[model samples]
Target: MQLIRAFLVALMLCAPAAARDLDGIRQSGQLIVCANKNAMPISGIGDRPGFQMEIAQEIAKELGVRLSVEWIWAGYQARYTDCDLMLGVARDPKPASFLRYLQALTDVQVILVFAGPPRDVAFEDLSDKVVAVPSASLAHFKLLEIGADPRVAYKSEVAILQAIESGELDAGVVSSVALDWYRHDRPGAALFALSTDILDVTSHYPLTIALRHTDALDEADYHEIAAKMRDDGRLQAILARYGQTLSAEFDNPYARVPDEISEPDSVSVRKDIVEELEDLARRNREELEQSAK
Candidate 1:
C-alpha cells in the first residue's frame, strides 16, 4: 500500500499542472474550447461552424477574450486535451469527475414529427397511428407500453423523417436537433414537429456548457454568464440561427453523468450528430419506391 501510494504521489508530482482557471485564462486573453470537427449544428470546422462554436464565441466576447478551438473528432475525450470549455453537454446535478456543468443553454427533446396538415399531436392520438422510433430506445419502449406499436426499421432520425415524408410511415419520435437539421436541409418540407410533452420517460434534457475541472472559474461564475446571455436575448438569438430552443433550468435526479472517467467512449458525444444523418440516403430509395408504386 505504501509503495502504491508513493508511486501515485510521484506521478501526480511529475504530471503537468491543471489548465489555468478563469482568472488565468482571462489573463491569457484566450478561452480554448474543445470541439468536434464533423459534429454539425453543434460543432463543426466547415464554413458554417456549428451553433456551439457561435455560442462559445459569444461567451468569449463576454469574457473579454478571444475564442480558440482545438478541433477533435470526439468531444467526450476533451477531458484529456488542453482545453477549458466544451459546449452542448447535457446538464447533470453531478457532472463528470473531470468536468463541471456550468449552465443550461438549450432544450433538447424528443419531439413527435409528422406531415400532412400542421396540427399538434397528442400522446393519445399516437395509439391508432403507426409511429417510428429508433430501435431499442426509451421512446420505443414507451410506445409499446402505450400500445402504439412503433416501427423500428429505420436506424436514423433522418431516415425515419424521410419515410414519414414519403408517406411510408405515419409519425416519428426523434431528437429535436435532428428535426432542426432536417428542416434546415428541407426548407419546403410539410413536416411538423408537434408535441414535446411525452410522458413516462424523459423526452427533454438541457444542453449545457461544461467547463473542465480547473481553477479558472467556478460553476457559479459560468452560470452568471449564461444567465446574462439568456436575459439579454443573445443566447436565443444565436440558437435561432440554428433552429435550437432554450430550456429553463430544471432538476433531474434520474439522469446519469459521465462516470466512465478513466476512458470515456470516443463516440459518446459524436453519436447524436452521426445518428442524425445516418442512412439519410435511404430516403432516396423510398422516393423511387413511391414513384414505382
Candidate 2:
C-alpha cells in the first residue's frame, strides 16, 4: 500500500510538468502578446484599448488563457520572436522574415483621402496634386506605384493629416480602417476613398499571431483552428465586438521560408538623420506658407 501511494504521488507531481513540456509554452496561465503602440485603430496605447488588443484578448480566452500585452515603441524589434505572439503583422510572402511562426487572421485595406471641394473625389483627378505620405509606410510605396509625383513624406500620420487640413498638401494616404474612425469622430472634414478601379492599392494586411517556430507543430494546425473559429462564427463574433470583419476574398497566404533570418538588429537614428528630416519638413512647411500667401 505504501508503494502504491508513492507511485500515485509521483504521477501527481509529474502531470503539470508534462503538460508544460507538451505545449512548449510558459506555464504562467497567460499568453504574452507584443504589439505596436502607434498603429492606431489596430494597435495603440490609449485610455480605451484598440481592436487588436481586444482581438488578442479574445484569442487568449479561446485558448483558455489570460492575455498579457507588452506594448512596443518605435524601433523595438525584439518582439518579432520573443513573445508567444505578436499582433498586427502584415503577411508578405516574398520575404517571410520575422514572421515564420505567425499565422494571419484577417485582412485590412489601405486608403487615400483628400481635403477638397467635396467628400466624393476620384483617383484619376489626383494626378495634378501632391499627396502627403509617411516615409517608409506601405501607403508611400503604393503612392509611388500609382505615379504620385513629388511625394511629400512626413514623419507621422498626424503630420500628414495636418498638412492636408491646412492645405499644405492636396491629399494624404492612411490606413482605411483608421480613416473610418477619424471620420466618425470629426465632422465637416471631407473624406473620400479613391476609386479602386483607377489606382487599386488595396493590400491584404493579415492580422497575425506568432508562436515558437521550432516547435513540432505544423502550420495546418493553426490554420485548422482558425478556420474552425471562422466556421463556427466565433471569429466573426469576436471581430464584431471590436467593430471589424474578415475579408471575403483574401485567404491568408503562407511561405515556406523567409528571404533572410537573423537576430533582431538595432535601429539607431543619428542626430544628423533627424536634422536632415527636420530640415526637409521645415522647407516643405515654408513652401506651403509661401504658396498660401
Candidate of highest TM-score: 1
Q: How many clashing pairs in candidate 1?
A: 4
Model 1, range 66-176, lDDT digits (tens) per residue? 999887664545634668888667766555566777555666777788888887666777777788876766678777877886898764577788899998888888778
- Please, what are the lDDT tens digits per residue for candidate 2 over residues 1-293? 68855654543332211112214443577766677776655676677466667666765666677877766754234323245666666554442243344445555555566676556656656667688765655556665765775365464455566677778888777666666556544656665656333455444355555543324454455555567777888767765545566655225454322323211223335434544555655665576578789
Give stretches of model 2 more than 4 Å off: 1-22, 74-76, 79-81, 95-98, 101-104, 116-130, 136-169, 184-189, 195-207, 210-221, 232-234, 241-243, 249-293
Whole-model lDDT values for every prediction: 0.70, 0.56
Clash numbers, per candidate: 4, 0
Clashing pairs in 1: 21-215, 21-216, 22-216, 22-217
Off by over 4 Å in 1: 1-18, 72-75, 112-173, 184-187, 193-201, 214-217, 250-293
Stretch of 10 with least lDDT, candidate 1: 253-262
RMSD of each: 15.3, 17.7
Model 1 C-alpha RMSD vs. true structure (Å) is 15.3
TM-scores of all predicted structures: 0.59, 0.58
